[model samples]
Target: MSDITVTTEDGKTSVCSPYDTTFVSKAKTIGGRWNGPAKAWQFDARDENRVRDLLREVYGTDGSPTDDSDLVTVRVRLADHEVSYRDGADAKFAGRRIATRPGRDSDVRLAANVVLIAGKLPSTGGSMRYPQINAGDDVIVEVRDIPRATLSLEREGSYEIVGETRGEVDVDALLTEREQLLARLAEIDALLPEPEGTETTTQEAAKALGVSVRTVQRWAATGKVEARKNDQGRWIITITI
Candidate 1:
């Protein structure tokens, strides 16, 4: 019921309607909903950072940055009228005059191996349809208002967006920690002296124990095994000849 005039920096003035004002105010209460495909699709660094940070914060030490290898391939059924894009080989690759194109081709050629990123909701069309995706199918992401450069994967390759909760952890730190733990475990195993009265040579013990010679060496290196050092500086295992 209140009247307010909104003026833009360009000197443009517009009278706000009661309904419009309410909608605008409500939008502010929420995150400011973006309607339509054009508005909904936005590729921004801040948004990308938000998603990345959300993942990292969730996974902790177990979470690491993954590339194409991390993506899970899936396939979804597409309606005949649905529009899809795919990579084409008909275009020229380099100045050498390639026979196939590199960009997206028509939907017909793209039917197989293309992953369904997003499709028209059945509710939008007045029908109840379930969206299903199968494993090993390729993923296709539509480039709308968002710039393609923001995506981490190759723009032309088939990919799938895996849906799973992941938390943030420093990968380098995690790897280092794992290596340290393994080293410590090796040291501990080495410190465990061979059972008393067991007539087993280092190589024989290693073979009988189903462990590598390097492991036996590690035991020797850490002084786990009681052995006699000959003049050649080689340890003769005292367990067994």
Candidate 2:
């Protein structure tokens, strides 16, 4: 867990960091774009030095040393969604272009021959979601080495990698994790007995608070707000508003 990670792959360098407006502005100035699929800002390989300098200026250091030992390079052919790369007389390309009204059927396919020859195809044992692509923008793909546990922890609002819990670590990541833990703990701590607002069911409380019924249920379970289950198996929430 580091404030910033610099990864170089496929002739491109990707820099991942926690969200910061200042860092984002500087990253854009150096030809960096948010690669949604990779969850990182990407730059051309030639800008590696500039990227490092930018990281230093913004974060006081290049936060994490990237390990490319697990990475495999693969070529990706990119073209504008408006242009056709196939033969000029290919009717399918023309038909697709007409169907999209201006866009092309530019599917990002992995080179199967190269994958088989290199024998570097990643294992499919982990949970991987399909990537989302912008319909009209230029197709850009970046592959990074992120662990499966990292994704799982992210869902529960934790970002630390598995088994790296001790020693000198990124201050920012620690601070962020601490904040999240404190917030959840505060929610749970609210379970203490108090008598103030009128008692209502989860649905009534949700409507009064302008939140969803499920949110009220979660609040009851977490003590985020005050609530308890009555004998009838319904949540009895105490809401002032």
Which is the leading candidate under TM-score? 2
**TM-score for candidate 2, residues paired by index:** 0.28
TM-score (all chains, Cα) for each model: 0.22, 0.28
Off by over 4 Å in 1: 1-73, 77-119, 124-171, 183-197, 200-237
| Candidate 1 local Cα displacement, residue 151, angstroms | 22
Residues 99-199 of candidate 2: C-alpha lDDT, one tens digit per residue: 11112233323321211121222222111232212222232222223322223212232122222222343566557646755864685569755545889
What is candidate 1's CA lDDT for residue 2? 11
Across 1-241, the per-residue lDDT of candidate 1 in tens digits comes to 0121121122221222212223344434433333354232122322333333322222111122232113233222233223212221211110011121122221222322232365432222211232212112232332221111123312233323334323344477558656755865796779988656554456876886688878876787788876565677765565532
Top lDDT model: 2
